[model samples]
Structures are given as C-alpha cells and as structure tokens.
Target: MTSGCFFHEPIRLPIDLNEQSDTLKGTDLIRVSKFYKDSKDGRFMSFLHDDARTLYDVFRKGAKESNNGPCLGWREGPNKPYQWLNYNEALLRAKNFGSGLISVGLAAGPHTLVGLYSQNCPEWILTEQACYTYSLVVVPLYDTLGPDACAFIINQAEINVVVCEDEKKCNLLLDKAPRCLRKLIVIKDTRPTTNQRAKNRGVEILRFEDVERLGAQRNHVELPPKVTDLCTICYTSGTTGNPKGVMLTHQNVVAAISAVILQLSEYKPTYKDTMISFLPLAHMLERCCENAMYLVGGSVGFYSGDIKKLSDDMKALKPTVMPAVPRLLNRMYDKVQTELQRSCMKRILFNMALRAKEGEIKKSIVRNNSTWDKLVFRKIQESLGGRLRLMLIGSAPLAGNVLTFARCALGCLVVEGYGQTECSAPVTLTIQGDYIPEHVGPPVACCCVKLVDVPEMEYYAINNQGEVCVRGTNVFVGYYKDLEKTAEVIDEQGWHHTGDVGMWLPNGSLKIIDRKKHTFKLSQGEYIVPEKIENIYIRSQYVAQVFVHGESLKSCVVGIVVPDVDVVKCWASENGIPGTLSVLCNNPEVKRLILDDMLAWGKDAGLKSFEQVKDIYLHPDPFSIQNGLLTPTLKAKRPQLRAYFKPQIEDLYQQLD
Candidate 1:
C-alpha cells in the first residue's frame, strides 16, 4: 500500500488485506510511484459507515466482535505489571455502573454532564462507558489542570458529578468545585471525608465500589445516544486564553474512527494485537483513538502517570501499535542512535545504512537487506518488544529526516498525520506505505479538504499556499456556549477554518506551511512564519528548542534558542569552549556556534532569505508544559513564548538596527 498518486476518491493502497503484508522482509522497498496527478475533488476513507450512533454503540459492537478477549489493561501501581479486563466482563460492569448511577439519583440524559477528572485508568474507561450508556455528556478533566481552570470548566459545563482519580484530587475539588456540583465519586477509598460527613455539606462522597454495588442490585436500561446528541464538551488547552469546550457528537466520533480505520484497513488489528495508551485521555486524540482500538478488537495497555516508566512498559507489553506525539518519536530515535554512536563501528555502519535508505527513497524502491535487518535493526526492534509494526505520529509535524530514520532504523511503519484537538484526532494520515516525503496524507476519508485563498499577504494558489479548511462528519459541532467564537471558525458553509497555512502536493497530500495567525509581515513586506522557521531551526543538532519572532519594525527574525546538551557539550570540548551545560549555554562562543549552525540548517531546509535567523539569543532553560511554553499536545505556546521573550527580542532587534 504505497503511492504518491492519491485519487480525490481515495482508493485502497496497493497492499492486499487477504495476504500478510509482503513488507515483512523485502529485497528493495519499491515505492508505489512518485509521479502524482492532482484532482480538485476531495475524498473520504472507505471504512466509514453510518452504523454506530454513540460511543456505547462502538463498545457494544466491539464486545460482539471481540467476545471474551481482553479489552482494557491497567496496572495497580508504578511497580506492578498490567492486568486485563475481558470485553464481556467490561460490558457487564458498565451496565451495572449505569444502574448504579440511577440508584445514586444520577439521571442519564442530555441535560446532565459528568466530569471525569483523572489520569488514564481502567476505572476511568468504565465510568466513561457508563456515561455514554446512560446518555450523559462526559467532560474530561486533565489531572494536571490548574485549580482555577478546573473550577471554570466544572461550573461552565454544569457538571452534575465529579469522578476524581483519588482522594487528593477530590480534596482539591472540594474547595474549588462549583456549589452546584452534587456528587463526588472517588476511584480510590480515600475521600475528603466520610461518605456521610461529605453528604452533610450538600456533596455526596461515594467510593467507586459503592456505585457498582448499588447498580448490581437494579436492572439497567439501554440508553443510547442519537447520532446528533452531544457526547463530550472537550476543552481545548489553549496557550493564550481560557480553555474552549468543543462539542463532539456520536456521529463525529464514529466518523473520526471510521476515517482513521480506513487508513489502517491494510493492517488488520486482531485481538492478538496490543496497543499502549500513554497520552492524556482528556485529550481528544487519545480518547477517540482508544475507542477506535476497542472497535478494532485490540487490547489497550495504560501507562502510569510517570513518563520515565514508558520504556519499561513498552518492553513488557511489546505492543504491535502505538500512537505518539513528535516528542516521543524523536526521543526513541535519539536514544537508539545515541547508543549506536557509543561505538565507532556501529556509528559508521548506521550512517551507511542511513545513506542506503536515503538513496532508496530517492529511487522510490528500497531494497531490503536481511543483513541490515538482522544485524543493525534487530536489537533496536527487540527493545520495543519485537512485534511492533506501527507508530502513528501526530499532534505536530516531525522532521522528514526523523520520519525516515524512524522507518528505517526503528523497523516500524512511521505514519505521519496532520490534525488538531478539534478534528477528533486525524484529519489526514499517511497511507500504510505511502510515506510522502514531508507531507501529511491527503484529507482523510471522512473529510473534504480545500485551500481558501488568503490575499492579505498575497498568498493564494498561485503562490502555492492558503489557509487549510476541512469539512466532514468528523468536524466538531461547535464551541459549547460561545457561538461567536464558534462562528468565527466554522462558517455557514460548514467548513472548519483550520487557521493553518498549507499547500497541496502534486499527489494531493497536504504540506502544512505556517499558521495563519503566526504569519507576521516585516516592514519589507515579506511574511515571516515563526513555526515554519522554528521547525527548520530545531533540526540543528545544536538546538533543542526555539521561539522565532519578527516585529513590524524588523526586517529579519530573532530567536530564543535552547541548545541541545549533548551536542553543545561535545562542541565545547572540541572548540575549547568552557563551562558546564548551564554555564556554556549562556557563553557567547557557544551561542555563536549554535546560531551559525541554526542558520545553516535553516538554509538547507529551503527557508527563504527573509525567514533565515539573523539574530538569536541562547536561553539556558528549555520551554516546557510547566512553564506555559507548550500546549498539552506539545505545540509551542506562541503568545506565551513571545511575552516571556519580549525584552530579549527587543534587544536583538536593536542590535540588528
């Protein structure tokens, strides 16, 4: 399943589902073809169906298909191995939980919103399914969310019940939750007070076991949602404003799942296949993808909140498939390559293999070398538990070299896709083996994509760039209560204004160029795309993080760069640059070394003259979620970054002047 010629009406890739993927071992990977013909008509995936109207529908259908197969896996603690729940058992528990909600006086309907505030856990999935089965809107809360943000969403969504992960979370909500919130359901035994004591304060506190017990004694009614009924009020972790709740319906979830599944049809996921869940469940990407995995009759393994434990989890699970952000993929690639660099012969051999892959990709036919597979690649693949076949990369764009190295060295199909929290996960994904150099696949099967001409900076099809827009069943309904904000993005035409700058490849894949709002024109009338430049610059070995900025007063861009520790340390050692990582990061010589290399990488990436970095300041600290520099999806917080770097930016511009 590989080719550059994507039809407006998506046809299946070249792979045959009936036969096992021939790609397991090959002489040379023959790329389907590089010659692409463009079509204006938009295509949706082949797997889409009007069948399931709700998440409950997906679960029930999966239960029927998977039968008694294990559906969910979670650990009791950081040190424990994962345990499983069979589909039939899970379905029964959900039915009992639904009945339990009724005993607790929690009515299931469109009017009631249940807030699920917790980390990823089996209990969380049980409660989430219980909500859908009872037709209640489930609002997910990030465990790391600030108190004020938590309070805002709980009140605005009118949460009827709060499902906390543990006692500490329950106590945090006790003081901050809106007075209207009625019940606190704790997954653990610890609570803010004794159940009777908490009830006297007008909030009933009950253990998870109590709800299940009460429901087990009652008969549960099947309450399914209409396709159009609201499902979740998913809050956006906005970098510059309050979180906006994007309302998703049952149809939206189905469409998103079907579209993603269509792209995945070639690689059938049977019950034997396992998936690891590490992304925050509060995030739409993880939630919808997990549901899709369930529908595919595969099991899901949950990771403890600690990221440091992910490698160990992967080793134990040896999952065939995993969903990842760019950070995770990069880490895996870096870790493996860094270890190889420890040996001179290994590094030389790895480079030779990398060069071979680069040549094969250029020719569109990669010759498979059993020697390379058995020698250089075998150990790395085994580290991931051997059976791994797919790593679905999304959330943000990854460097093309990173994508290539991942596929070649990591021994997995690295499928890069384009999407946002609002799109329910994937708007477009790379066809199984059709890895377009640097492009996200054509618009997904359920989505119709087009570029709306942006004339303000003279950006139009003539220039090969425009604002990317998507319309489909998978698109969200709207912002929960803010129609004004809603109308601004979703037009009367039903197209979602993605606010992303993109251009289509000859083969119809979409190449994201810049963000609509991040484009700033200098006095010279040239547009500067911060993310576009930043992406190119970050590929430099010397750079770890960067925030590029250009003002109307400036003619070129200035950046705040966080140098890579290992790379900088080696450079310091070789060039007689002094000081430890913290000290050297601020050293003038080290800054100059990084700035020069960044410019070189930027130029190599085809950045325009105006987009090149003319001035840069090396920041000692890397931007992180804790400092408000990244969104949960790991995108740069542009507004926050600019504000934090304002003074330094001004000084850089003055120097340029």
Candidate 2:
C-alpha cells in the first residue's frame, strides 16, 4: 500500500477563508455572513435569480434554461432503469394539475390548502409544483405520523382535498377523514372498495390521471404567488404534543435558496448534476435542497419507497449529489467498518489509505481521483454511485469518527449542516473542502446567528456557549392558528429562539452541544443534559442506542441501552456465552459487561460522577419511527421513550436506591 501511494503526492487546493467567515456585526451579538456585511440596508439576498421571485418562478426558470433536460425521474419497477420527465414535460403536467385542482373546485389562491399524503416520488413534486402554480399552500402528510396525527393536520389546516400515493394510503385517510375533507385524489388507480367508503362519507374520489385530463380540457392560467404569499404550512414532528404548523412564505423559502447558492458559490450546483431524493420530502432539509437543485436545472430521482432498496436505487441513478440524515450515514459507516474487520491485512490497508486521505483533508484538499482513492476507497465510492461529488448531512449531529470515515472513504465533499424547520432548513453549512468534524460551519448569507444566555442550563453567550438564535428573511412567519406558541419561539426583536444550545469555535463555526428542552434536575438540584451524556455513551461498541433519563425525585440518572446486536453477539461468542440477542439482554453477565463498558467510555469522555448513569436497563429492541419511539428524522422522542420504558426506568431507579 505504501509503495503505490508514495509515487503520487496529494494535490494542494486554494482556499479563501473570507468567503466562509461569519462576521460579528458592530458588537450586536449577531453574526451575519461576510458577503452581506457591507450592504446598506443590512439585508441579505432575497432571491438567487432576478427571474425567480417565488417557488413557481424557480421551476419556470428551470424550464426556460434546461427545457429538454431531465427534471424528475423514478423507476417503474424493481431493478428497472429510471424513467424521466424533462423540464418541459414536467411543467406541462404541473400546469394541467393546477388547472385540474381548480376544476375540482379548489380555489386558486394562498387561502386554499392542498394536502400531499405520499412518500418521495415524481408525483409528489408534480403536486407541489401544481400547488405553487396556483398559489395553493401545500401541507405534506406522511405515514410515520400515524392516522391520528394526519387527521389532526387535516383538520387543523382545514384541508379539503388530499392527494394520496395509493389506495392503501387513500383508505388510511378515509378511515380517519376529517369533516373538512371533501375530496380524495389517488395517485394510483382508485380501488372499487375505496369508492363506496368515499361516497358514503359524501367525498368525491378522483384518479390522478383523470384530474390531469380534466385540467387539460380547461387549461387555467397560472395564479402565481407574491413574495409574501403563504407557500406552505410545514407541521413539525413534535416529540411531545400535537404538531404545530410552521407557516413559511414565498420570501422565506426563496431567501433560503439564495443563501444556499451564495454559501456554495465556489462549488455551485449546475444542470449536469443529479440528486437521488430519499429523505422525507416533508422535512425542510430535503425540501430546500430539492428547490435549490431545481433552480440550478439539475435532475432529481426518487427512491423506490422501500428503504431496503435504496442502495439499488443509488446504483441505478448514479447520482452526483446526496442529501441525507446522520442515521443513514451512520449505517453506511458501520457496514463498511464491519466488512473491513474480517481480515487483518484488509483493515491495515484501509487504515493506511485513510491516513493518506486524511492528511490531504487536513491541508484543505479534497479529491476523488487520488492514488489512495483508486487503490483502497474505490469500492466504497462505487457503493454510493461512483459519480458522487457532494454529500449533505443534517437533522442530527454526526459522530466525529464516522464523519471522518465518510470523507476519507466516500471520496466526496461531506458537508454537515445545522438547522430546523423554523429557519427553512440550513442556518449553517460547512464550506467545501472543510473536513473538520463536529462543527456545523458558519451562518449562511440569508440569516444572522447569535447565542443568548440560558442561566438555568449554565450556558452563557459571553463564554461562547448558549442557546442559538437566528434572525433574517428566512425565518418562518408564525405557527398557523397559534399566536401564543409563535410568540414563545420568536421574540419581539425578530430573533427565533432555537431551543438548541451551541458553542462558537475559534474559527467561527458553531457546534451543537446540548438541547435546552431536554435538561432535567436531580433531587440534589444538579441539572443533567441527557442528550449530551447519551452522545458520549453511544460511542461504546456494545451500545447501539442509549437514552439517559432522570426524575427530579431521583439522585442520579438512569439509562435504557439498546445493545448493538452484531457487537454483542460477537462478544458473547468469544466469551462462550450462548443465546439470541433478545435472550442475552436479560443475562446478568451480558448486562454487567455492557454497563462496565459504558462506564469506562463515560469516564474517558470526562463525564462527572453525578452526570454518569447510575443504573441501566438493557433493551433488545431499537428505537424506531414506526414504533413511536423515534421521530421521522430518526431523533429519539424523549417523552415517548419515557412512556414506553416506564417500567424499566422504575426498576433501574429502584435498583440504584
């Protein structure tokens, strides 16, 4: 490995630090992008292109610039090649669909809301664009939300019509159809069984293609939205209570796209790039990224709806850009690491190659055609489609070791971003060639970021650690029909109080350290941030997912640990213990082994005695969205987790006492 790598030195790349700086403004406590520091009105960019004022305008511009280029694609069947629709074709369908909605009695204005109840697909984008064409606000509905949550959104948003992916979802909506719902549009053919129930409920059922044909017969003119017109009501997946609908205006989303364009100016997206869309379109991160791609006239292909086949879809699409959540990336990292562990020689070669690549990364150089890449990382690169050049990770903080492994193994620009739905996805995004892990890069051009003191949590802005606050055109207007909730997050001075605590690094980047809402006090009045402690314990090889929990009545924290099945099984085999993972979870020896490892990891990570978990319950089942223990974005739902493991938690506390 050394002989092959020694012949070629890593290439040096030019870097402009000024372009990536977040300038502190006149001792104002807020930091804005350097590119907009000299502006007279102190406002960042409002739109990426003069021709694109609204989301509909962005699509129209794409059609004008790349009319014959592939716009949306999806596979017709398993292992089949992806079929595509060019910009011109997609535009026609959107126009027809918008007209169809009007013909079906939906008012064409910002007041009308259309619900999209589907997974990521070409039809989902078509329906969204159609809504944009007629100034209709879109409200996305997904299955992970369950029928009850879906019903709540449908009733709360006053949605009259819902577009479902298939008859199964159509039936799901029908089962809990709200009184406000008047019509159902099924993307697939309407089943005979659905017709009777829909009719009995006094709601009209229409097929997707029939609606298009109906619209084609009477092509209505576009009712484009103004800059301040309501574009969407994105309902956040709350871990605790009923979801709140975050109202985002055309100006808000457009400014967000502009921010992405300016931040990635040096490595701008172009018409030649293609992205495989797998992340939930309901989430702001995926939605914003897709809009940015559309603005640049790039192609977007949907995953086959089954996550198990995502790899097959990636290989088929060979996409150049990927927007992902940390959970997916973590799985990829774990798989590769497991594969390399089979042979000592293979692991040695991979380590040598990773070292060489990391050396280049430290020098701010990223390239996929280096000797080490070709010799050792070629297989990994090809696993995600050999053409990948950029990977955007968000929704959660990625582990430092996993982040470094992704950059070195995938041979691409792995940019970590930090944001929430209130800010329209990206508040801070790492610049190209910045391989440093654990810190999300400086603020984007559209918004200003500042840290405010949180006294109870002991986080202070003066010390460069506190609750993160953002202010700009990209901030959402308010929560729908909930003025009191809106006021709770957005202050009078126009700053949106992000409930996450962050620390500013010396280089101007922001690192998310803890969550403000997840803090709990012990009986002795010591505050414990469970998320922070869990992050440390998750580093243990035996732990898959850990949830640290404490009660005000308890003196110390307790945890529920989901043991890593493979790692635990391997350990049991080496130690001459025998059982399935579910059985071994109850074994005294296995429990002791895992607890000791977690304690060692916590001690090594500088966790204090009070902060460390005093007792733990080994859980064989992993937390997941379907089980209601995790959100759709794969974040642990603390309240739900507590409710789910109430018995185990009580046992742990009793044992500790």
Candidate 3:
C-alpha cells in the first residue's frame, strides 16, 4: 500500500439516483486497482456501489480494522495520552442521542455561554454510534468571530442544541438565549457553575455526565444508521458572504474518507496509524480525517490550543501523522532558520545539512549524522512529537522552501493537499516519493481532475492554465439552500470549478498558481498574479504576511509586510537595530537588508518584472480575522486590505523613486 504509484478505477455511478445533476451516486461505481487486484495488498481495497450507502459501509469497515486507533483530544502537560475509540463506540455514542431533529451549536473553547431554549454526551458502542448519528447539526464558532456573525450562523442553523467545551463558552450562547436557540450541553471533563436564568429560559444545560445518564435510559436502542442519515450540518467560514450550512450525510464523510485511505494506502498500510488533529474540527479537512480515523481505527490527538504550544503538544502526542495549515509549516521553517542564525555553529551545520540534502556538498565536506541527531536535530523532532511519520498541509499554499527544509531537517515528508468544503474535503494530495513543491499533487483515489480555460485569462499557462476542476463521489450533494452559488461552482457536467488557476505540470501534476478571481491587471495592462508574487516574499525569513496589488493609473505592485517576529528580533539584536515594529520596518537599515534579500530571491524564482514587488510597506499588524486583513483561512482579503492601507502604500511607492 505504500508506494508512489496510484491505482485508477474508471467506474462511474448512476445519474438516476443523483438528485444533483452534476454528482454521481448509487450502484454505478466499482473499484479497480492499478497497483493490485486483491484486498490483501496492505490497503483498504473494498469497492462501493458508488452510492453513499457503500461509502459509509467502507468507512465503518476501516474503523473496525483500526480498532485500537486513539482519539487524542489534546495534550495535557508532558504526558500526551492517546485516547482510543472503536467504530462501534463512536457509532453508539452518535446514535444513542437517537432520532431527534436537534440543532447543534459549537463553543470552540471555554468561557462561552449557551442560551436556554437551547442545548445538549457518551458511551457504549451502540449508544455512542446512536448519539453520533442524531440530526444534530454541529455549528462551529471560533473565539475570534464577532457576536453578530456568531448570532447569524446560530440562527441560520436553527441550532436547538449546543455542545460547549466549558462554562465560559456556555455564557456566550446564554446571553443570546430567548432567541432561536433551545438548549445547551457542555462537554467538559468536569461540571461548571450553573446559570439559573439561562437554564430556566427554555435552555436545559447538562454536563457530559448527564449525557451518560441519558445513554443509560436508552432501552432496546435502535440499530446502526443506514449510512444516508443527515449526521451533521457544517457551515463554511464566509469570506465572500454569509456562511452556507453544508448538510453532510454519513455517506459524504465515509466516501471522502475512503478516497483518502485508498490514496494513502501505498505509504500507510496499517489501520494502527496515528494522526494529530489540530485544524479546527469544524473544518471539513479535520472532520473528514477524524471520520477516516474511525474507519482505520487510527489515533488522532488534538494539539495544545495555541500555535505557540503546538511543538510541545507534538512531542507529547508523538503522532505518526499530522495535519496542518501552510502557515504552520512556514512558521516552523522560519523558526528553524532564525534559531540557526542565532548561532554560528548551528548555522554552519544547517547549511551543511542543506548542501548534503541537495547532494551539492562533497563527501569530504559533509559531516556524518551519527552524532548529529543529538547534537543538532533532536529538539526539532521532539518538538514535532518525535514519532512523526508524515505531515499534511492543506487549506493554503506551503512554500517550496518550507516543505524542502522540513523534509531535510525533520527527516519527515510534508504532503501538500488541495480541496474545498464542498468536496467533503480532499480532492488532491501529495503522495510519497514523487512530491514537488510547485504542484499541489495529483487527484486523490477515485477523483478525476480536468482543466478548463477561462476565456478571459491570457497570461497563465502554455496551453492556457485553466481553472482547476474536480469530480468524484467526494463531491458534496450541493450547497444546502444555495443552488445559485453551487451551480456557479459546479457545472452541468458535475465538475466543480475550483476557483483556483492551475495547469498540468510536465509530469501531469496540477500546479495551482493563484485564485482565478484574484488575478488583476496593472495600469500598463500587464497582468500580475499576486499570489505567486506573494508566495515568493512569504518564503523569506524577514517577511511574514504580504499582499501585492496595483493602484490607479500606476502599474505598480505594492506590499503590506509583517516581518517575522523571531527573525527580526534576532536580526535587529545582531545589527544593533532598535525600534518599534513600524519604526523598524521604515528604518533605512532594515529596509535595505530586506529589499536586497528579496530582490535576489525574486530574481532566482524567475518572476516577471511586473509580478515582482516594486516596493513593500511594513505593517505593524498581522493579517487576521480580528484585523480584517485576511479571511479565516489566512488568505488576504484583497479589496478591503488594499484600500485600508492606501496611505501607507502611497508612501512606499513615493519612496521607491
């Protein structure tokens, strides 16, 4: 199951059962393998009828196979315990809540409140699956989301029941009680202080123990779900507009998981695999993977709450697999470089390692690593949970240098993935052996990719880089209640146009350059792909967040840069530089240092003159949801950000002369 080659099955599902015109469903699909014909090839090789039902069955089978897999929730101190839950256990817990048309609310961390007229846990194989299956739509709310946005999603979801992590989280919903919400159920290791008024307002709040109590009351409980049941309603983080409530059937999760498992089977043969789940569970990436763990009975551990504590959590969990966002890997690369720069010996060792890595160093100059692990790289590996096997980065682009460095330094492979919530999760992911930084990788098993030209795009690919489109069972039924937007994305042929601009690499891999909609024109009429340009700047240690855009009448590309905190701190100390972030950005010395380095990097990357950053303005702030500079996924919100920093950009442009 572990190799660079992929198996292709040409089976297509029936269209009659598919309610959506552009989707495949039920009875028409079968499994065919390019690698092997038998299921004993150390992979999950069972085929489904191309229906949601079959998909769910396969998922359960995978879960049953990986019975000892753990669901590690988060690291506690130095001992990160791996918590295992069997498929029967998860199913019973989900099903025991039983047949209720309940709405679910999610309070990400503690300190949130659940209102009355609101809310809702656990145990026993039958009860676990039962509770897990209820028509409880889990609405995930982040700590940073504004109250109004939070209220909108809750009301839109009509969430009658909520699952809060702690008391503080319960309070947020409690304040909003008397509105659309009905009940609150908090999932905590222990109970929290009760709010009398909140409870009386038609909101019945209960602790995890209460859930256990409810499970005890179920006599002669129902059997396992038929797989097509509406298990959860996951909402997308609205970047362009209001969030859409995506109703994912048990089938959707199962199908997506099967595709991923089959795709990774080559590199990972056993169901006893382990994964670190740090991405928001609300996200399809984590949700789908979590269910995938169920199929394989794999272990999944939640890292410490903050990114700052991720390294420590990693070591504690010692996960065999990890899923991350590009930002995380990029930051790790920055950290390592900054740390290396701090010491002469470490820097020399790192450069030597890199040279050896690229096979550019002579045998005489390359130092042996027999003692190197303890001397140089053990801390980095330990920070990543030591047992690290493979790292997967999704939701955004990971710089090539970042990926390459981690592979060489950490002695682990970093897999880059591409997908959207609508596809249930993954569509394409990098596999072992044939990974390239420029390409996001190939289509996942059972998925098909096609490239279609955007009539308006003229500067993209040789054959014209088309908008990347995908079709597979992994595709969601459609956006719930948003047919127009759904249609705009998925066409009559069932191919989902991924808004991403990409072309086939010489090796047939897909290379995503930028968002098709995000590409803009300069005053000289020259087209600029900002994402490509920004990726170059972002890979540099001195730059963090970057945005490149043009101004009126001028074909200039300007940037709002957030310098790497660690790199700047180290660089400033060594250079005897001092000032606030803003002052340091404008300091002649700092600007000269960054500009010189960036110019060289850009030149080496072979960027077009127009695509190159003409000037960069240092921004004291990081682009985040709170600041409105970036979308929830950390992508720059172009229009708003460009206008907001118009003055600073103008100043930078003036200085460029």
Model 2 error, position 75 (Å): 1.1
Cα misplacement distance, residue 89 of candidate 3 (Å): 5.0
Candidate 2 lDDT by residue in tens digits, 360-385? 88876666778888998888787787
- Model 3, runs deviating above 4 Å: 1-63, 66-132, 135-137, 175-178, 189-194, 200-202, 223-229, 355-376, 459-464, 569-578, 585-589, 650-657
RMSD of each: 6.6, 3.1, 7.9
Q: After superposition, how far is residue 30 of candidate 1 from its true place, in Å?
A: 30
lDDT of prediction 2: 0.86
Using TM-score as the yardstick, the better of models 1 and 2 is 2
lDDT of 1 by residue, 1-657 (tens): 211122122234544322211111132111111111111133333234345547877887777767678898977775577889999898888878877887788787877888998888888899888888888888998755667778889989877688888877877777676877889888888734556555666888877888988899886776877778888888987766778998988778777877767656665455667888988889888887788877767789887668988877777777887888888778878777678768999889888877765554443343233457666777766666666766788888787777887776665556777887677767777766664457887666566666778887566865557888777778898998899989999999888999987876655567887777777888898877788788788877788899888888778888999888888898788988778888996688888888888889877878888888788988878898778788765678888898999999889888888
TM-score of 1: 0.88
Looking at model 2, report the run of 10 residues with the lowest lDDT sum. Answer: 1-10
Tally clashing residue pairs in candidate 1: 11
Which candidate leads in TM-score? Answer: 2
Which regions of candidate 2 fall more than 4 Å away from where they truly are?
1-24, 37-41
Residue 189 of model 1, lDDT score: 82
lDDT of 3: 0.59
